[model samples]
Target: MQQRTLDILDKVLYGLIIALFVVIPFSEAGINIFAGLILIVLVATFVITRSVRGLDRGIWQPILALLIAGLLSLFFAADKGRGLHKFLSPLVKYVTVFVAVALTARTDSRRRWLTAIMLVTGLISAGYGIYQYGWLSIRRVYSFSYNPNVVAGYFAVLTALSVGLLTGVKSRLWQFVFSCTTLLGLGATVVTFSRGAIIGLVASGFVLFTMLMSKAKNKKAVLVVSLIICVVLVALTPDMLFQRFRQIADLENSSNRQRILLWQTAWDMFLDSPIVGQGPGGFSAQYEKFRLPGAGDFVSAHSVFLQVLAELGLLGFGACLWLGVLICRVIYAQLSTSDQDLEFGISLGTLLAAVTVLIHGLVDTAFLRTLVGTSMCCLAGLAYSIGLHHKDESSETVSP
Candidate 1:
């Protein structure tokens, strides 16, 4: 009976992950918040049971680490209340994501379903971006989302997921789907006019080609052909692509000029509060005092690392670095293991997505909002489960 209950909980968790993507577009409508309540309830029940069982210790280590850092960071924060709230707000949902994916992905089939769901959701969102950017004449000079940077940030992560599955997934159909998703999603990302995303995509592509083709000599040519296709497409639509390309340069772009000011101001904040720094939420609040006279609003540090330093100070920076190392280690483990084809592929895909976020995060505070927040934490669970289950034949978590 206890085992059965776990199985049901796991299913609900996976279901919620899929649902979360569906709700993201409507998140501002108040409906998403309402839906989040349901997810919160499900998570509470699972945690209650799992905590009682005392088996959630290993599964929740990342959460534990971050929680500790958040509390510790608050001690040094300029605004205690702001620091504590910002630290805790995103952390709570992320913990739930870790629990959900970790518990659900103990099986091969479950992992695949997760991958498929990601692909489907990404494809749909990409399609919307295309219409919004192209046909509707929405003028995606900056971003399609509430912010243009978020579009790029989200795309970088999504593209990594699609690319990861290219080498790991087994089914020809799924591989084809992955390929389609990559092309379409990437195309939409460029159209969103997010140069930051473009940089992240380039990093992901480089990583994907090197990792996938380094071993398979025959596939090296395939990688070449794919790169060529991407180039040709961009070249053919240079006008469309150039619209995005134009704004990246400080010399040629007004936005670049503004971002430079933001970066400098962010650095100033870090310098002023080098140790404890301003509270996690204090950056924006205090921006007006330091912002350049001509620069518009006082916004966040566009760079994720900079934001971490400004908000959590040096210790929080160290903690995040440790997490990055651990994620890469787990991804390497999945790549090295030989037994399960699907799990290996899913792990590869999931890791790439995480990699995308890490790279993009360095350039953009992609985690400042909830959409990326939920996605990142869930992917972390997926990576963790892969590492844990690789050696255990008695236990498996489904994903890929």
Candidate 2:
């Protein structure tokens, strides 16, 4: 029963990895909700018939709280359609991530392979950004729902993950691929002209610095390459990058103004509703009606943190925070341990990058949106794999 349970969970995880990396990216494929449903069913079956691992215990209350929050939000939501879509969609996605990671995190070797695939996909995704910059100047490449800011933030996180993997690498060949992938991803980050990406990149670097200080392995090499990358990024895109950073200092800029307004609007909604929010998807639609005629369309709350708070209120926001802290603590605990080298480093990098993206989320909603849900899920899975590896290794060490 135990062996069969492991085999089933392993297949579910590998299947998820392949679907996200291989099937989703190469074409106009939507991540079928059916796949997630099947996986959940399988998990339920395993828990019922076999002795399941206890890793999922950490996530149980958080997931339950999020679901409860989502359900409660429906009663107060101004727009039921928008609320249902927004709340339910993320609820489903986050649950998938929690289950997938908890079940499959078992071995260091498995974690390495997971990192390999995400980094490789990051490179391929960067190709689209490159195309957008060069030939797809027709504005169709990243238009409407897929704006430049979103792409920049998304790839910024990707670049950080790739860099983390590069540092985490053991083999010479893998190390070379990391360098190539980082350059390509960094190139894509440049083209997006996303100011938020720069902030995320900086935050991710700080996390990397913490890792370096703790492990203190490759000091000179990390410093030299990092300096060179920083110089080139600044020198190459001096105007666009500098202007965005400057906007942070000078809040008079239009983009800065827009973000403030969106935040204010969210605040207004939350203040009025207080206990219950304006509803999950209701923010965009309701916000536009209050704006002047002929004004631009307001699609999102801009900040994921505010977006959740405004829509779900204190209860929902608390649940989200709970889940986030659990994942971070679990992964960081593994990374901080002195068990394995490459696998620990990979998990450290992934968790850092994932946390960086959440920080980016405070400014942008790339992962929270459906368009990029698969990408975010894959990143979370990568982090979970890292944690699982450590758990497996520690168990092995104590077996004797």
Candidate 3:
């Protein structure tokens, strides 16, 4: 009877996770609802199972520190109530999703199932983007997302996942499928015309290809096909895409100038509060006071690292950095010892997804958006879980 109850809770948790990936792209309310359900089920599962065995508990330490920093920053917040709400709500959502995935997805097949759902979600979003571009003549496709950059960043991660899947899956049929999705995702990313997204996609793609080159048997064929697709995409791209490249070096570019000004203001805010920061949601509220002369109207700092510095100060920023380093260390260890192709696929896909988002985050709030951050936390959770559950006799260790 106990076993049956545990099985039922596991299935429910998995279903909610699937719901989260599917609805997050389309509806914010849906994400909230599904995430809440997952949290409830996760609690029940934890109590009934009466154990946290096989879950990677190490990743939680840095996350806990970051949360503590955020909570403490509220002491200096302009509006303490808003700061507390802002800080805790998303943190709870991110932690809930991470815990749900890490605990529920115990087996390799279960992990792959989650990835498959993510791929399907990406494909659906990409298809919508293609439709918007081809039929509506939209120059930049945002699809269901709020901004073209957000959709582009999302696709950059998906494209990396597809590349990882291409080499990781053993079956020829699945490889072909992943290849098709890769091209589709890339096409959608191109239509978005997001410069940061493109750069991140390229960086992650290079990593994925390099990893595959060392392991996969059909490396030459994959390289040839990928190059051919790249050439075709370049030829078919609109003049606006080329214009974006040309404007890259031009500091006077409207958006580029704005980001520079915002970054300057962020530095000033950091100087004012070298620790703890202005508090959660404080950057936008306090941005005008710190705004530089001739700066345009803006709410966000437009860069994740700068925004964190302005809002959280150095202590919170350090905690965030520590969290990132811990995650990277966990992934590195997993990738180093992964003997199975399945583990390779999960680790590579997770790594590329993270790297792509982080690269994009350098120039934009890629990791701060609700959906993106949640996705990122979940990916890290998946990698951490895989590392913990790895069947090898040797145990993986991370030093403090």
Against the hidden reference, what TM-scores do the models get? 0.84, 0.84, 0.89
Any residue pairs clashing in model 3, and if so which? none
What are the per-residue Cα lDDT tens digits for candidate 3 across 1-400?
A: 9889887888888888878877867776788899889988877877887755566566668777888888888889887887877686576687788778877666788887877777888799999999999999998999888889888887877787787767677899888998899889989999999988888877887776776678779988979977996788779888988999899899989888888998898888888998989988888878878888989888778888888998888888898889788877877787778777767777787788887887888889867776677767766677767876763233544423
Which candidate wins on TM-score? 3
Which one wins on lDDT?
Answer: 3
Alpha-carbon RMSD to native, per candidate: 4.1, 3.6, 3.8
Show how many residue pairs clash in every candidate, following the order shown: 17, 1, 0
lDDT of each: 0.65, 0.67, 0.81
Off by over 4 Å in 1: 1-15, 25-62, 76-81, 141-144, 219-223, 394-400
Which 10 successive residues of model 2 have the least lDDT summed?
138-147
The RMSD (Cα, Å) of candidate 2 is 3.6
- Report the lDDT tens digits of candidate 1 across residue range 1-400: 7677766665665676666645553353332453355456565665758552222354346556766766776776666776666765565555655555666576677666766666676566678877776777876722335766676566656677777666676888978977887788787777766666677777766777777577876896877787897788668564756765765554547667776777787788778777655666767756887787667775577777787777666666666677667666766776787466666665676666766776777667776666666656656666667765564544434432
Residue-level lDDT tens digits of model 2 in 1-400: 8668666756766666555554434332345553365466556756766644545566678978888888888777878887887665766665665466445545555656665666666667788778876787733234222567666655776677777667766888978877788778777877777666667777888778666766657788777876897777667774756766767867767776787888887877777676667777767857865453333567777888887878888888898889878877876776656355565555666676676677778888776754345556656665665555556667889998
Off by over 4 Å in 3: 1-8, 43-53, 209-233, 391-400
The lDDT of model 2 is 0.67
Positional deviation of 352 in candidate 3, in angstroms?
Answer: 1.1
